[model samples]
Each structure stands twice: as C-alpha cells, then as structure tokens.
Target: MATFAEPLRPNVASADVQLPGVRDYEQVDTEIIGTLKPTAGWFGALGVAIAMFLVGAAAWIYQIYWGLGNAGYAPPVMWGVYIITFVFWVGIGHAGTLISAILFLFRAGFRTTIYRCAEAMTVFAVMTAGLFPIIHIGRPWKFFWLIPYPNWRLIWPNFKSPLVWDVFAISTYLTVSSTFLYVGLIPDIAVLRDRETNPLRKRILAILSLGWRNSEPEWRHFMKMYLFLAAFSTPLVLSVHSVVSFDFAMALTPGWHATIFPPYFVAGAIFSGIGMVFTIIIPIRKFFKLQHYVTINHLDAAAKLALFTSMVVGCAYLIEFWVAWYSGVAAEQDYFWNRVFGEWWWAAWIMLTCNMIFPLSLFSQKLRRNPTWLFILSIFINIGMWFERFVIIVPSLSHEFEPWQWGHYVPSWVDMSILVGSFGWFFMWFLLFIKQLPVVAIAEVKEIVPPKLRSHARGHGLDPSGHHLPYGTETPGEFD
Candidate 1:
C-alpha cells in the first residue's frame, strides 16, 4: 500500500476540483477504515443509542398493553405523532437514493465521498419508518394482513387505499435500497477481508464480500450490474415519495385535498433527506477524521442542492395557499387559514422558518463552504421538516369540515417516548453500521480520485486487475 506523509485535510475550495484532497488509494483506505476501530466515544454513543432504543421499546410495549387509545388520540385528530413521524422518516430516507442512484447516473463528482453514508441513511430511515404503521394499527403481530398473502379465507389488502399503496412503496424501496447498499459494500468488504488478521472476522467478511477478487470479469459484471441498479433505482427516488403523498392528496379532507401534493411531498423529502445527510456526514467527517474524503467542497455542493430544494418547498407552500384561495371553496380556504393561524400556529411558523427561512442562509457562498454553519443549518432544517409534517397532518385532521368534529391533539408520554425512541432506533443501526463496515465506499472513492494519484502498479492497491486502470477506462475499472 502506498502511504502519504501527511494525513488528509478538509478541502475548502470549490467542488469543481474532482475528488479534492484525496491522494493515493491507501489514504482513502486508511482514513475510512480507521473509523471501524473502537474508541471510548464510539462505545459511549452506542450505550446512549441502546438506552434510547430500549426506552422506545418499553414505550411501545406499554402502548401495546394499553391499546392505541394510550396514544394522544383526540377525536377529530385520530392520527397524531405516530403518523407524523412515519412520514418524517420516510421523507428522511429519500435523499439516500437520490444521492447514490440519481447523482451516480448524473455523474456528479461530489457524491463520491458522501453517497455511501447517505445510502446507509436511506435504508435505516426506511426501516425506522416501517415500524410506525404497525404501531399505529394497534396490533403489531397481525401486520402481515397488509401483505397479499394467499390465506384460506382469501382476504387481501384494499387495493384502493393509499395506506395499502404505502405497504408496496415502502417495501419496494427497502428491498431495492438494501440490495443496492449491500452490492456496493461487497468490494469494500473484500478489502477488509484481505486485511483482517482475526480468523473469525476474516471469515465473516469473506462471506459478505462474496469472493470479490476485483478480476476483469468481476469488474465487468459489477459495473454492468451497478449501472443497471442505478438506472432502476433512479425512478424510485421520484416514485416512492409520490406514493407517500397520495396518502394525503387522495383524501377528501379540506387541507388534504390538493393536486400539488405529489411534487410538493417529493421536494420536501429531498430537502429533509439532504438535511439529514449533512447532519450525519459533518459529524462523521469531524470525529472520524475523514475531512479529506468528505470535504467542504462536497458539503458546499450538497448545500446548493438543499438550497434548490428549499426554494421548491417554499414555492409549494405558497402554491398551496394560492390554490385554496383561487378555487374559492369555503372549506378549502378555511382549512388553509386555520393551518396558519389556528391552534397549531406555532408549529406552522416553525416549519416555515426552519424549512424556508433558515435555508436562505445557504445562498451565501461562505456559509455554504463552512462545515460548522452548514451543520447548524442542517439541524434546523431537520427540525423544520419534522414540524412541516406535524403541521400538515395534525392541523388538517383536527380542523375538518364540520365545526362539531373539531378537536385539539396533545401527544401523551407514550407518544413522546416512542418519538424519541425512533431517533434512538435510527441512530442505533447507523452507529452499528459505521463500526462494522466501511462508511465510505473504497472502490468508488478510488474511481473518482484524480488520475495523477493513480500511480500504483496492479499489485500495490486493492485492485485485483493485472494493471493500474486509468480514470476513464470501464474495463477492470476500480480493480484493474
């Protein structure tokens, strides 16, 4: 392995420089793989995550024992924090596929450093999102009824319900996203396997790596399949969120009925997902000392994307009010009015400020390039996105057409515990993931590194191909 005298440093320049701050193949390996090593902080984080998850699990058990009524189920606002959180997690999961698949297809260079962790976030967020439907249904065990199973009674899920569509959408997203994530990990795991001295660990990695030898045939097959998956997964970025939106747009309720919802939800999902990517990667870059790989240039590019989505989301908000007023439907206009100034006005304003107002700061070039500011902005965006969902779901359900049915919802201790637990659940998986596997893609990182850095002979690096591959060569690409 080729070694550099200096450790990798964060790149503060424009992302126009391809794979900025990365040098030899071994530097990528050394820095990214180093994150897998155990530290006191890692243990401490894991302990906190475990405790949070256990508390959430306990809250869930209590909910199950006491029934769904134990949640903050006000009459008109039957859907509360659980449904809001479900949508939030689903939205959070969107950026991963967008970064990994859509950005890959577009050949975006900035994605090279950050896409691995983003993809992981997608899978875990979806996993966390999946739990809410079962919890909300009040019967966790019989959740299989949502599936199209061939039972003796011949009962099947309602094809008309958007809730049923969610089952298909979330499941398909999870299946494809999980497969894509694991496929990308094979080569990286092979690197870990070859370097392992522990017999048991080596054996486990060997199995996970699926005999990845980086040979010519393997690279050919790998690149072809990767391209295919990227193409296949690209449509999913648009479709999954659109389907989630249908849950609202298809409804007859005053605030819920809107044609703009599909695109509106899609944009919001991307915005939130990117916000989460910043939240996760900034810390990983700082703590794991992976600044060179996940540089300021990369984050600046991401901030730009977030800014673009923020505009789209802000526009959607304006369009919602415009359509309601323009249509002149009393119920529709009333619902819109109540959403902004009624019982949950504070939540609505927070959503507006966080999602629309705060993100405006990213338009400044300096803050876009500053990791600290970007991190702080990303936190606000996530919080705003959460409130965005809360405002959307709760207000609409609470203030429906009939005045007699109106009611205000307040989340119980159970609701709050479960909500907090969901974060714990998400972080627990993410923490375990970073510790066990390479958080950055080794093969993909090598693919994007500048040609000047590709000085090694075939045997000197992770590539099993006979010779060093150039930047543009498709054959024996990462390995050759």
Candidate 2:
C-alpha cells in the first residue's frame, strides 16, 4: 500500500518529474479526509432536503389513500402535473448521461470532474422521475400489471401502448444508470475504506467497495469495465429520451403527432438537464470550496454545451411551426396557433424566451465565463424547460379537435405539493451523495494535473505527451 506522498514514476522518467496517469494512487486518502468532515452548510442543505422529502412523501401517501381523483386528473386531462413533471425530471436526467457517457467516449478531458456529479445526478433524478408514473397510476398497487409476468392472471402489458413503452424504457434506463454510477463509485469507496480508521465507516465502505484492493490488475480491469459501461450508457441516453418523445408522437392528438418530436425532446432534455447540473454544481462547489477542482473551465464547458442545446431546441420550435403550417393538417395548424395565441399562450412564449432567447446570451464568451450570469441563465433555462413540458402536455390535451370535449386543466393542491416535494426529494438524495462519496474524482484529477510533468517537458522543449525521449525525459531533480 503506497502512501499519499509516494509518487509512482515511469521507469524511464526521473523521480522528481511526475508522469501523468495515476502517479499518486494514494492521493485518495487525503481527499477522503476532507470529504468526511461535516460542514454547517451541508447540514443546512440536508435539513431543507429532508423537510421537502417529508412533504413529498406525505403528499404521496395522501394520493395513495385518497386516490388519483385528488390530483385533478379528470377524463380530458388524464395527464396533469405528475406526468408533466415526470417528463421534466426525466429530461433533466439527460445532461448527466451526455456529459458522463457521450463526452467520455469522445475523449473530452474536461469531463473527469463534471462526469461524476452529473452521473450521480442522472441516477437519482431518474429514480425520482420513475416514481411519477407509478404514483400517477390510479391503482398504484397494481402497477406491476404493466410488466410481463408469467402467472395465474395470464396477462401482459400492451406492447403497442406508449405508456407501457415508457414503463419499460424508463425502468431499463434507471437500471443501467444506477449500475453505471455504482460501478464508478466502487474504486472510490475502496479509497475511503482504506483511509478511514473509524470502525463503522470502514465497515460500511468495505461492504460497498466489494473487496477492491488497489492492485495494478484491479485498476486495469476497472478502467476497461468503465469504458465499456460508458459505451453502453451513451446509447441508452439517446434511446430513453427518444422513447419518451414517442409517448407523445405516437398519439393521434394534433400537436402530439409530429416527426420533429424525437430530436426536439432530446435536445430539450439536454438543455434542461445541463441547467440542472449548473443549478446543483454551482452551489455545491462554492459551499465546499472546491473551486480549484471544479474551476471556471468546467463552468465554461457546461455553458457552451447548454448554449448549443438551447439553440437546437430553438430550431426544433421553428421547425415544428413550419411543419404544422406546411403539412396542410387543419388540426395541427390549429394546435400550433393555439399554443401562440390561445389560453396558454404565455407558457409558449415563456418557453421560447427562457429556453431559447435567454440561453443564447451564452454565445458571448463574457457571459459563459461569468459564474453569476451562468448560474442565473441556468435557472432560467430550467424554468423555461419545465414550462416547455407543461405547454406540450397540457395545451394539446386541453384544446383537442373536439370542441365539445375541450376543457381547461389546473393542477390541484396535491399535485402542486408533490411537484414541489420532488425537488426536495432530488436534493435530499444529491446531498447525501456529496457527503458519502468523493464529489470530485480524486484519482482522475490527479491524472489530469500531474505535478512536475509539464515543467519538465517544457524545460526540455518537448511536446505535452513527453514522448521525445531525451528532450522530454529530463532528470526529475532539475525540474523539481
């Protein structure tokens, strides 16, 4: 077992010039020391989160006891706030997957710190999102009826039904995401287990670490497994969000039946999800004094990604209107018009302004670099994205083809309480995660900012990779 100060040098390089890629494997020990210290701000955040969780839990219990009728979901508005928030939270989950999986596959080096927190967010957000459909079910107890089970009942979920598709898609996504998050945490947990002298903490971490011993072979296999998991997660993000979009597109409702729904939904998901990443990360970084690691660079990268996705969402909005007008479908045209000038016109405009126009400011380098502005912009994007979901779900169902069936939908108190509670629920889980695990990837960061390597390479006038033999491999003491 190597100590934190014992640096592992490449055989070819001198001891003083630290090589990149896991030089100080024991740095994890120092990192865990800070992570275990309880802070006032963390406890404050946790307190609020717990309160919110309790409120949400009580609301859910009420729903279970009193039934779905309490939620203001009548015939015309079968899907209300629960379904809308479900889609909203699920969309917010996309950015994490995109950041962690897609960017990793592309070798985006900046993702190292960003990916861990975002990936953890993805898992918890999905878990909270998955609860909506189950709670929305009128008979919550019979939720398993949607599954294909071999039993005396001899029944199967309808494969053709979009709702059933959502069940399968979201379930599969949650499973994969949770597995990915847990796999990534295993080595980090082992680091904690090795460092902790406390019996309780050591026992807990030992169980979670799964007998991991930081051997070269273990690290090699873990890296390969991580790469494989990343590959698997990339497609899952795309497919899960697309399937959610299909839930609406497959419907015959005028506004719902559009070819553009898939891409539009996915882009909006990324946009909102990235907004959430900033929403959570900015505060966490500031509170924990992790600015050195989280850095302005990470913020800039996330801002750029959010800006691009917002533009993509904006384009989707334009294309949707064009398609509605050009397709010669009367109902579709009416639906489009209703969105802009009808009862919920304000919502459509809010969505456009907040999600599209506001985030566009990030196009400026100044705005992207400004943390305060970036945080505000992210909050706006989140609000707008939520409104976007509300607009899509409600207005379409509210003002359908049949004038006789047309009705306005308003969320009842139970719905509002639960919606608010979900935010608390999400934060509760996230707060726990930050406390219990390494919020930043300790080993990965050490890999990125290897000490003495850059100075040595530069002194020898060698490239960053340090592959130029005599030119790159300086005597370590000279650089140190």
* lDDT (C-alpha) at residue 159 in model 2: 96
Q: Candidate 2 on 78-187: residue-level lDDT in tens? A: 88898889999999899989988898787766677778889889999998998898888867788888888898868777899988888888999999888988888887
Relative to the true structure, how large is the alpha-carbon lDDT of every model? 0.87, 0.81
Per-residue CA lDDT of model 1 for 1-480, tens digit only, reads: 998674132332232335435656777788777789989998999899889998999999999998999998979888889989999999999999999999888887788889999999999999999999899999999899989989999888899999889899999999999999999999999999998889999999999998999899999999999999999998887888899999988989887888899999999999999999999999999999887777666787799899999999999999999999999999889988888987788999999999999999987877887888988999999999999999999999888889998889999999999998999999999999999999999998888664332334524432443333333322211110
Runs off by more than 4 Å, candidate 1: 1-17, 451-480
Q: Pick out the ten consecutive residues of candidate 2 with the lowest summed lDDT.
A: 9-18
Candidate 2 residue spans exceeding 4 A from truth: 1-33, 451-480
- The RMSD (Cα, Å) of candidate 1 is 7.0
